[model samples]
Target: MAGGHIEGWSPESLEYLDACPVCGARTGQELLYHGLRDKFQVNTPGAWDFYRCGACGSGYYNPRPTPESVGRLYEAYYTHAHTAPLEYAQLSLLGKLRRILGNGYRNYRFGMHERPASILGILAVWLMPDQRALLDTGGRHLPKQPKGRLLDVGCGNGDFLLFAQRAGWEAIGVEPDPKAVEVARARGLTVHLGTLETLHEAPESFQGITMNHVIEHVHHPRATLEHCYRLLKRGGWLWIETPNLDAQGHARYGENWIGLDTPRHLVVFTDRSLLRLLEEVGFARIERLPYCPLCERVYGMSRALAIGASPHQSPPLPREERVLARQAEANARRRPEIREFIMVRAWKG
Candidate 1:
């Protein structure tokens, strides 16, 4: 099932990376999987292959889309679509309840607010889980420092920046997509139009830095994290969210795991591997959070499509979401390492 070429770059622009991006080891890398697809969206042409480093157990795409050709990989990307800011007041009672539950759990989980508002809040805190990366989507996890400088790497459409601005942080972002940058700029956001590798900001300039679903897309994740390390002040926080290679969905779905994202998700990390990378970058006080709901939703969609489900379907007719959620919960209770999506927070020390 070969697909068409990318929009702006030729196939020849793709490059093969032989060395392990995390450890810089040239040998002892083993093939982990093959024939992954752009299953989440766009159904792009070409099968992608993934390999794991024997030294670090970190996984990455071998012949990946080069930095130059990468732009073409996202031409039909959904993030470029303009969307109005959400109006939460208009949400239904159930939605509002869920929001409250989510927020209560977040505050309690992060030790931001130890006392619950009520019995319901306590129950909410107990039921709902925490993922710092997802919370950053709404700027819910901004540092206690008022008006502190925060940077969002690969911030698309400035949605998070808007939330951060409202939360009293000086929000700025770096994005590579011209259309996404245009949309963010239209919203009056301060966004640099380039990759983090190209952005040369002053050292220790930011109090908090977030990379939500962005690290896996970079060609060299270690280099990107190194840049993040240099950009953060001592004791600053670095939040990262990416696909988990040890996720239960990957165990169940194999190559069709939605989080894989084939060619786009160049690197995938397990809990141990990601923790090691953070430690190597001088990040301390690290915390690993729960699986993101988006990963489960995406896994369901991928399962549906794999079984010949209609592409026009909105939610894709629920394919084992609840079952997988229960399975993930059970596994996390036992090992806490096998779950979809890696959500972690560490401090620059």
Candidate 2:
């Protein structure tokens, strides 16, 4: 097999898998993409190949960076930066109204106590399904578990940890990156400085566990999920969100899809394959959450990539692309498998 070498890392440093990571099938593998570069970050130097498993419809990089070397790819990751909360005084009138209403709905639904909230906000948000969906996602779809313990794997600067803390959960995080862990700890969060594999939390300790866009980056996704299963209480919930291999964005842009962030994303799963994995892992009451309003951002970035433009520095998205994004969003609502990302919540039964 042909491969690209990263600087300072020999070919032997890359781990080549002989079987499909998701299903363990080795006989029927098909090469879907070759010579794919890290277009989004542009920091990793390599032309990677992505293969699709005929048995499972999942995708993975064969010669992916080993556990020791993969940290180099995330040296400049977005999670290293600390995010400040929006100040109430700095918001425009409309922004303030939206914030107030959002807070109100959160307080009512998630048992939060955010200030400037009004009881009317619940009715207002209930009338807007799209906005409600976004709010639920922001809250990780976990209902308020008063004094419940929550663990965020790959917590990344602890943004969600802060949110969960505010929502009445004892939120703790596990992060691998030292920089990100430092930033998260500076926020006064109780974050364990390592991956889930290295986390020494007692089994069945957490009421809820969440992994947002973290599973694909792990060297062993199955092991990660199994660890999460053991960490949650028997009736606790586990939430996960990752890029869907069979998304409309992939169909539209193919290799240029922003979801395919090169060697960083070791495995990209389809909805069916992900569901199967969850079932095999002894999770029950699995529910697929609705895709949030993200088509514009995803499609815009993909369009920028396709046109050889930096997604961050590119001009405004074209009107036609916006139209296409709206159309895709509507299509995803009806046929959820086509959504750009897969979000699921399951119970450890």
Candidate 1, residue 18: Cα displacement in angstroms equals 1.9
Question: What does candidate 1's lDDT look like per residue over 34-85, in tens digits?
Answer: 6656665545777667888888778888777878878877887766876673
Superposing all C-alpha atoms, what RMSD in Å does each candidate have to the true structure? 4.8, 1.6
Tens digits of per-residue lDDT for model 2 on 47-102?
A: 78899999999999978888887888888888998757679999999989998999
**Which pairs of residues collide in candidate 2?**
none
Whose lDDT is greatest here? 2
**TM-score of every candidate:** 0.82, 0.96
Number of the top TM-score candidate = 2
In model 2, how large is the Cα lDDT of residue 285? 78
**Which stretches of candidate 1 lie above 4 Å from their native place?**
1-12, 41-43, 85-140, 290-298, 308-321
lDDT for each of the candidates? 0.73, 0.88
